[model samples]
Target: MKATQELHNLGQSLWLDNITRGLLTDGTLARYINELVVTGLTSNPTIFDQAIRTTAFYDDDIRKKTAAGKSTEDIFFELAIDDLTKAAELFRPDYDATGGVDGVVSLEVSPLLADDADGTIHAAEKLHAQANCPNLLIKIPGTAAGVPAIEETIFAGVPVNVTLLFSCEQYLAAAEAYLRGIERRINAGLDPHINSVASLFVSRWDHAIGDKVPAELRNRLGIAVAQRTYKAYCELYDSPRWSKLAAAGARPQRLLWASTGTKDPNAPDTLYVQALAAADTINTIPEKTLLAFADHGKVSSTLPADGGDAEKVLAAFRAAGIDDQALAAQLQLEGAESFNKSWHALMQCIVEKGQSKSTGTQAEQL
Candidate 1:
């Protein structure tokens, strides 16, 4: 059996952290679904930027959209929705089979709005309505402002993927926001089962602190953080408050592991994958990580519900003068900035392409 199937059977969803027009056109995404147990996918500015810049697949559409006077951002979202809508249909079966628990494809709102709660909320609604897919999730960052946007988006019945969370506290905050939104819906006599996921990023933690921590702690902070977060997740689900809500038709907001790809070549390729395995959670892996896992990954033990040794590991990092909370904040800020850079570059690439096409046509007339 493929390691991905084993992980899926273990109850941890395997989502490919990538999507492109080429993947869809070539049937690669479908094959991953049929063969590799990839039930879902995720995309961001960086992914789309790479796809649009490198592929000729979107050039004609870009030309048409540019000629129509659409802004670069407008063109980008049109292309994004076209691809994500298709991917959503491909995963529709898993979505139906699980009653919307798995098989969710995520599209993030503009990273430039990461700090603008109102902007984020507005864009989320527009994108969700535009996507018009039951299994689609609008990804919002877990920044302080984004927390309110997440709650409001959920309250408005838009499924959300809370992204860029780096600590257990951050994950908990996002979960709380989700619950608040669901509870509000129940109060308003609306459906309470608003699907959502709090995506806690892994691997980056280890990359950030690899040289700062002890050898025993290297490549360990990420899993330790996830282990701790998973315990909180289980506890929250079993809580009387959540149970009451669940009885009233509310669903638990799932915990998701993002940035699971190994950053250090020296670390085990499957380090994050093997350590963060748990039922009802998800691990979004890069294509390389997915292939590597299929080749050599082995799951020794599932994450303990009790958060086994998480605090001990965290304490070791603290002793090394690494404040996980402060670092998590830093990472979230940097991640948002990185996406903004990618978004700007993407727009520039589109404009340049559009101009080149226009100039070529004019020359042909000569």
Candidate 2:
């Protein structure tokens, strides 16, 4: 059996961390669904930027939307929504089978809203409504500003993929925000079964620390962080408060492992995928990593519910002079900034492409 299938059977969802028009138009996404156990997908500004800049698949639509005089941001979202909704349909079977637990595709609100809570909330609602797909999730960063937006968006009944979370502390904050939103729904006599996922980014931790720690410590910080966060996740799942909410028909806002792609060339390609295998959690992986894992990965023991030496590992890093809290803060800030940069570049690419199309048309007329 494919290791991907084994991982899926182990109960960790395998979501492709990519979506391109070519993938959809050529049935590649569907093939992954039918053959590779990829039940869901996630996208961001970087992915879209790469897709638009590198492929001609979106050229005609870009020209059409540009000709319509839509703003760059508007054109981008329209294209993103169109692609995501189609991918959502392709996964609809898994979505229905799992009762909305898996098989969802995520579309993020403007990364520029990373600091603007009100704007994030509004855009999240508008984007979710615009997509009009039940399985589509609006991603909001788990930054300090984004936490309140997450609460507000969730309470408004928009399913959210809370992104950019780093430490266990950050994960808890996002989880609490999700909890507050569900609690408000119950208070308002609304259905408490609103779905959400708190996405904790991995891999970037190791990349950031880079040779600062010893070789034994290299490529290990991210999984250690995830283990610590997973322990917290287990605790939250067993919490009496969450049980009460569950009884009220609220779904547990699942813990998702994002950025699972290995960043260190010396590290095993399947390092993140194989090590982070825990049931009931989601691991969104890059396409290359997914293919690598499916070909040669092996799933061993799953993450221990009690965290499996996570604290010990963290302490070792602390001894190595790594400040956990400070690094987490830095990573969160950098991640937001990275996305903001990608968003701007994506918009600029759209503007240039749109203008080039117009220029070519006028030249032909001449």
Pick by lDDT: which candidate is best? Answer: 2
* Candidate 1 wrongly placed segments (more than 4 Å): 358-366
Model 1: per-residue lDDT, tens digit, 1-366?
Answer: 878889999999999999888899889999999988999999999999998888777777888899899998989999999999999999999999999998889999999999899999999999999989899999999999999999999999999999999888888889889988998999999999888988998888888876887787788888888889989999999999998899999888998999999999998889899988888999999998998998889877899999999999889889989998899999999899999999999999999877666444422433
- Tens-digit lDDT track of model 2 for 202-231: 999999999999888998899999999999
Candidate 2 accuracy as lDDT: 0.93
lDDT, candidate 1, at 331? 90
Off by over 4 Å in 2: 358-366
TM-score of candidate 2 to 2 decimals: 0.97
TM-score to true structure, per model: 0.96, 0.97
> What C-alpha lDDT values do all the predictions have?
0.90, 0.93
Worst 10 residues of 2 by lDDT: 357-366
lDDT of 1 at 297: 94
